[model samples]
Target: MTGAALAVALGSTGLVAVGTPAAYAVTPSDEVAKLPIASFGAMVVDDAHERVYVTDGRRSSGESAVLVYNFQGQRVGSLPTDQPVSGMALSADGATLHVSQSHRMLTFDTATQTRSGASFVPYDVTCGRDVAVAGGKTWFTETPYNDPYCDRPDNIASLYGVSGTSHVNTGWQSQGRLKLAAGPGAPDRLVVGQAAAGADANPFLTTYDASGETLVRGPQRRFADAEGKGALDLKDIAQSADGKRIAVADGAYGTRLLDASDLSDAAAAYQPLPDGAKSTAVAFSGDGTYVARGAAASGSTPDLLIQPADPANGTTPLEFAFEGELDGLRVAPRGLGWSKDGTRLFAVTSNGNGGLWLHVIKPPAAQHDSRFTGALGTTPAKPVVGEPLGIRGRLELDGPAPAEPVKVTAVRKDADGTQEVAAAKVAADGTFTVLDVPDRLGEATYTLRFLGDVTHRPAEDVTVTVDVAKAPTAVELTAPAEATRTGGVEITGKLTGQGRALPSGIGLKVTRTDRFGTTGELTSASVAADGAFRVRDLPSKRGKTVYEVSYAGDALHSGSSARATVKITG
Candidate 1:
């Protein structure tokens, strides 16, 4: 609720919905800064110096600067540039930052944020470029054209290795734009994926052994199936910390885990993303303990997911839904970066309207245990149809108090099928109340869930079943003591019911009886919104006459009737 804390509600359609109470922090995280840039090119985290470098790739000809922010997201300084900077990568030792601009490449000392050196690049293209550090050298991609043609399929994009004041053409080229990824886990290896620019329909993903003098290409891969249905739409790439595996963020597919050597599918793949979400960026933490998967999803769908790097670890992910102007709409392409310690995750998000934000998140170092403490209890021992029922339970969570209050989600299942109930806010004492109105009779089951948060693991679900009974309805009648045979006998009455409001325009059955005990059915009386109705009838038989009003119950209420005695005179 204070500082950079945000309250993000997780969508049910997602694989994991980590719901948090409103006005409460979604996680122990913060949106550190609203980046003052129209477009995002790249993000690089300098763990050694506790700084972050973000480039504004929107500018082509005008002078721009690489925006620098401290770990807390405060703008510390900027490294001015002659032209807009595009791609960036941090050196293996964290001493140098390799940045690529439209015309040339620049290096900066991570500790001082000062320009260390510059190198000449052949192409002065405005299509942007990608930079990476591998084999004790700097590597960058060159898209040889200006705007509008940057994404053309026939555009010549080449990979070049920075050598002191000049760049050596690696002689490797691809159509459209090229993306580069490298990590300390595989210092000698560089992974490349063809961007989904108007280039190759089935873009290729390959690796190169950069340890040698010449760039030796490694396993190459294409994703198109026999029917050409699954073409690679590369958005970002990441190699595991140990270099044994690689992860690709393909818009066409979800996140793809591949063997770093053969590019074959990894033995285990992550679960598919929430529906309607497309992969945009991914990164493994410097320590290889976690992987941050970024997506471009709308509404409540999570835009970012932080989970265990190893897919086998079935730990539920901590999800973040970025909505509104302040937080941006979704994670940007290649927007995820992390500190080497694996504690802080830096993500860049962009709204479709050209707004951007920088989020600095601190994932819990350890997840604590949580559990349902006692048997679930329900109020109004006997639940009735069309009435509110409250389910009460206690959740015991370990570790310190949550940054924000947690919530419990509920679902109701009956003969009609299952439906979700609104989430209940957990009180400070770990108590929560799930409220719902039962609409059907017979047995109804309610299941409650606590999906957990960044600091706690999920608690086992609890369920309670109750028998729902129809609501009781009654009719009251009032009549005059006597009436003439020729004159009509008038009666007035009211209908009353419990739980949900009774249906409007109700019609009650009416009957008339004389002193002889003979009874005859009469016209029905219509009830108004106020449940009041009037009846009029003539009594041919003299002496005593009786008028009765009755109501037959619907699916939600039980039937009831009332009678009034009246004297008749001829």
Candidate 2:
């Protein structure tokens, strides 16, 4: 196929359908700058000033440099370095750019593109491949490139942190070293894909905090390997906008998802692509709902896959392939000064003669535009029998409020079955409240749903658990040795469980069965604050007597000890 056809097939737009397929601009609005480097390890863009910063490492002479370029593709400034550069990072504010070169960490001012600081903190491993700047600290990974087959050293991988104020040339002590899976978190935490020393030897995920302290670790989970051959290699990691979810690039195995809150296990909800693609780069959109992955194979152009951040319904990713040669691939988003309004993307290409090529990517139009916000609240649970209970919540939204009318519905289900209870519309501030749950109608679980005029986006339903309260659990009935018309019985017990105190009221009913087989209903009393119940006014009948306590609608019978022979007193 002609180059233009190939470019179109590879998801590029810059093309002319002529005899030889001429190359034009794809997203002319989105541009890229070239650098003087044979091969690139890592690169970052400064979208605020329309400039790009790249690490230029000359393999033969072992010389390294940091080169800067404008969005219009002009060489602006270059900084010479003694050691080769490996990874790069930009501060949250985009004021500083941190570069991880051979055995040292260097910083440059974003405004001037000059060396601001330097440090010689020899990383645990040689190749300081990935770098991230966040929370006032710089983080990078040291992975050995020498022996890819050898059993990775227990200490072969580590994440180093340096304060922004620390000079780049100072020989600083490593904040801490940790065994991670593959890609660590850039600015703050390091998300590793390997196992620490333990019985759970499977390849898992963990995050090391900014202080180089291990914050959270994921349960043992397996990933695909390099060739899509064995299990996956957790090679690259990226976080969603809200930082609640993490996307792990498993070479050949595809990408995996983990909960950012605890870094515990793969989210129960996730979507994996078809196996066989070698995923190299992973990135997330600002809202944390979309994720993009870059894939390529030997002797082929690279492809891009876009999927939902946390996909539950098995959906496929939107795939786009690269048109020309794939070189230094990095994600430059907009909104953050380093990215163009956080929408455009740039891909660096390399020709045989050591020149740089650039490819610009424009995001597809947005699929949905509505937004949702709300505060969820639950009732004072664990109420005793016959107690009233419920849950309350509120919702908020932006833009002209929906006026066509909205409804809030509550659906409850239990060991018995499911039932719908309440429905209401959103108030002016886009607020809605629900109250007064029914009595324990043998139900254990309840869900709340909000239906609006527009079905494009429905408020997610919330779940509330309804369980039997244990307060006033057990009741004891004691009869006097001699039957007496004035003497009664005392019932005392503690209520305990996840939910015990029902707000409305706590009532109990007592019943007695005589030896004559006749059953008599006794006095009913409200349970005390301590879940204690006492009833008086009993019959002086002899033979044997049985006592039972009923709370709400469920009944409990006391042990046979509550039954005993009675004699009339003098």
Candidate 3:
């Protein structure tokens, strides 16, 4: 049918017509920063200086300097070191940055960005070291050579007292490489855990009393099922501000929240991660209000999640996925760090190419609720199968005006099953229309949703039911089975339509063709209130005569035709 004819045919049917984009849409995540780093080693956020320090560990790179970036992600300066840097730690007052080199420990003044002091006389340090400040003193770790054993019982990894002489051990020793974390403002509380190594079957984690000069080990842990199924594959650990809770990034599990006092499971835990993403890092904001969890995932999978620290809040975490060229594929191990105010999070991402990128992301931490207002409305009041449909409703957001137009997604459920409808952008006045072309012919239920952005909470779902129907028009004919060649011969028929009643007294053009070599156009029949019509004709001759009747379709009803055969006996 021509476009003009199809438009006229559907004019009275009251089906909605619309124009929309054909591409599918995803949640928008702005690219805030893309630092070109040759390699990724460590990332630490300095709240006091409003700067972030990153380094290229002893990998394939030969440059021996710590790259510094302000909270906004601009390259500020570099802290040149004697050797490649490993673990980085900040003092309790945030004045000094303690960096661990191969065989020595160095401290940098945050105010001057210059080296303050250094220490040596350490055992030949081949394996990189991890450093931290605890118990009002600085401490460092030492693992012999570059080999981390999994089965050895020897005291290969030892803890040292760095406050005065880091060259000597504080008398705490373990079998594998150890990682450290301290509660901000709670130097007395220290957390140490074993990095999963080649030999240790059950890695250990314990808290320590750092208020004293001596190391006092506290509640210890090594998670394993009865059959030793779920052993701890520790990547990173973080201490809460209140010194009451701890969060661990476990490769086996996602994020595990533990009680600070006993190192047991906390009353609540973090939500499960999106599929195919494993826990690579975890950190609690300095204020203890939010937590950032990092995962090594690709494509549209979430690589970072920032959500409420308290699992009880149950707020959906803001998600970030890095894809496309110039974008990293996944989050590196222990790659997420947060600023003091939770305003910014610094992440290190590495792509398939040997390059790495430093990303400064500001996740949505504040949210306002949203709801639909008034009654739901739609275009073309009654819906029809294979026709465009428009469901319109107004959304009232509790937050300030958004930076960009808000989008509303819709899903339809019917006999064939559920399908996702193309998302519609809301207008500045908060009115939005969801358009769809329903493929099925049964009851179609539309469920509209607002996934909410960085500043808004998801709106409550709105549902509307639509009755879809098929287009109308049918024909039936009646004639004597055997008609004589007389003037009494008459053919009658009835026309019917579905959706709306046909226009009364509408004219239906008719045609008649005899089985013989004779054919002629019959007079147009006027339809009656009962939708019945008739045609009368006289047979010129006789053998068999065929009478065919047809009605041209209209705006609301399709065209139909019927034929009757009579044995015209002479």
Candidate 4:
């Protein structure tokens, strides 16, 4: 889709859009700072003070530190740490910033530019990624480095909590650990995703109550599957303001949306990018209307795709293509603070020198929409069979709301490469339902076309792919063997795999071969609750007849039953 089309689609959401830029402008004013060295770690923004914080691990000197800056990219001060600072977090008040380095957590008083009561207690294991602060405590992921096994033991991957009130020399105490327990809310508890387990790693998202002793494990969200194809090496996570949703950036899965209410089944409910974009950092807009995902790249020209909360209705995201190189390749998003009004977004990055890059996310001009916008707010670019893909969309009139009715059509191309199936006249609410698309051989693209009543403009189309069965299976046919000549034919069958029912709503095409040496026309049917189908009024020809079942897109066919001779002997 063109950038203009993407903007128009998203404009329906009442948001201002910007056009795509030919090239990013690099002004001397855009230069943030020059780092002391090349190493990079984490970057964050303090929205309250309009300042940014960036950390340099100082792997060479072992005296890592964080640098502070004003919104204009001027370096204000630098706070030094005893060990390498790998991950960082800012308190809600933005007065205290926490840094994790060499298995220790230190609180820095940003106002005083000094250590707050000597860093907090040190952790037992090295942290893998970013840290989050919530409910008066600091949370970090502990992935033990000693384990030789590919998957870290349950104890190796834990969410260690340190009291914000604790002093560094006082020794931070462990709050609680996440584990499997039985109870009404037991399944909701979060666990740590297995580290280095490839696809079999299961990560838990655990949270604790006030006292911190009684552990409340929310749910175990698998980071990777057994095959490692969808493995999610989650690097960063940020929750929406209302805490209703959490956006996680997995190395392999891009960004995953989790329902905070039910953490147990949230992984299964996640929506990932079809293009398999790798996300290095994630931050939710203040109001929770949009999410900004930072792509991990060393080059200055990185494409950041802004995904919307809803994808089914063709809401494409806004993309900001950067012009300069990122100093820190492994840099985590630091100072992720939104404006009080939620209008502006700020991010910090390492420029590979001793300098830091201050990234300001401003709303693009009203007229220009970037290329990344085309990917947002739409259904997954690719929809898997049996999934109840959502579609939330709005119609845009040239001037005012249309005076007459609008017709929305969903056209599904046959997987067989020959036929086209269509559904017309969607409801007034701009909604349509398509079920049981047959498991075709290759990729099938579905287009949604909207026709305005009085407007003479051409119809608008949104293209999305549909993936067919991953394994080969025969199409089952079920119907009455002997039927009355006057009645229609009811065909029914189950699509099974390894003795289990396939995912629901697989579409299939049924055809009949008559003894006359000519092939009959094809008919389509969606899988039902029992995987059964009934097609009435199948026109019968003379002599014996044979019925065959096949998928819509592919040429594969199911085993045909013996011909049932239809003798019309008068």
Pick out the ten consecutive residues of candidate 1 with the lowest summed lDDT: 1-10
Greater lDDT among 1 and 3 belongs to 1
lDDT, residue 407, model 4:
41
TM-score of 1: 0.77
lDDT of 2 by residue, 93-150 (tens): 7788888765678888888778888876644234345676644566665544453322
**CA lDDT, candidate 1, residue 243:** 84
lDDT of 4 by residue, 151-250 (tens): 3334334455665544222122221222211111212222233324322354434333322444444434554456645655655666665565666666
Best by lDDT: 1
Alpha-carbon deviation at 293 in model 1, angstroms: 4.0
What is the model-wide C-alpha lDDT for candidate 3? 0.73
Ranking by lDDT: 1, 3, 2, 4
Candidate 1 has an lDDT of 0.84
Task: Report, for all candidates in order, the number of backbone clashes.
Answer: 0, 39, 7, 65
Looking at model 3, report the run of 10 residues with the lowest lDDT sum: 1-10
**Candidate 4 local distance difference test against the native:** 0.48
**Residue-level lDDT tens digits of model 3 in 173-227:** 7776788888674678778888764454678889888887587888899887778
The per-model lDDT (C-alpha) reads 0.84, 0.50, 0.73, 0.48
